[model samples]
Target: MAVAAVTTKRKRTTARPTKTQPTTNAKLIKQPLPAGLPREWYETHNRRLKAMRLAIALLDTGIYHPANASNRRIRTAAERIGIHPPSETTCRMVRSLIHYAD
Candidate 1:
């Protein structure tokens, strides 16, 4: 005796796709840094800012856990957010920021 195979059809939705809003190109006003600050301090400050931006971008993209924020993934997020590609150190900083976020 031969057995017959059965197939099931999947249902499709007729909902229309919504248009995504375009991103704004607003420029941020620069604040002057205080004089006499060490060069390392400036570097660290910028690194922290970039990391924070990356962390927020990742969070916006549904990556709430730091474990899921690998370097490549973080870089991709940065690209999506229109940021320059971050360095290895900056990627680590972004993960740390995500880990410490409440």
Candidate 2:
């Protein structure tokens, strides 16, 4: 008696295509500042600068009491200079300017 052999073929699996975000290949170049943007940037810089200057003045004037006093003064001065609710970056700079007497 001869036995019959059965062979099964395996199916091949194909990888699914992945979605990709569209991207630009052009080199990035900074465009010239618009007429209004430079002035706005300068004004912002001026306000932050004024805040720093006032903080420095406070330090120089011997008003480092409670530490926060100078910080508050800095905030107030910033507002007085037309900057409302000063940025944390500017405030941090002001805080860093403080010096303590040994």
Model 1's TM-score against the true structure: 0.68
* CA shift of 48, model 2, Å: 7.3
Q: Per-residue CA lDDT of candidate 1, range 38-81, in tens? A: 99999999999999999999989889888999999999998988
Query: In order, how many clashes per candidate?
Result: 0, 0
Please give the CA lDDT of all the candidate structures: 0.85, 0.59
Top TM-score hit: 1
How well does candidate 2 score on lDDT at residue 28? 56
Residue 80 local lDDT, model 1: 88
State the lDDT of candidate 2 residue by residue for 9-82, as single tens digits.
56669654433422356455555645756676977666667556766655665656435645567677656556
Q: State the lDDT at 3 in candidate 2.
A: 38
Error of 1 at 37 (Å): 1.3
Consecutive 10-residue window with the lowest summed lDDT within model 2: 15-24
Clashing residue pairs in candidate 2, if any?
Answer: none
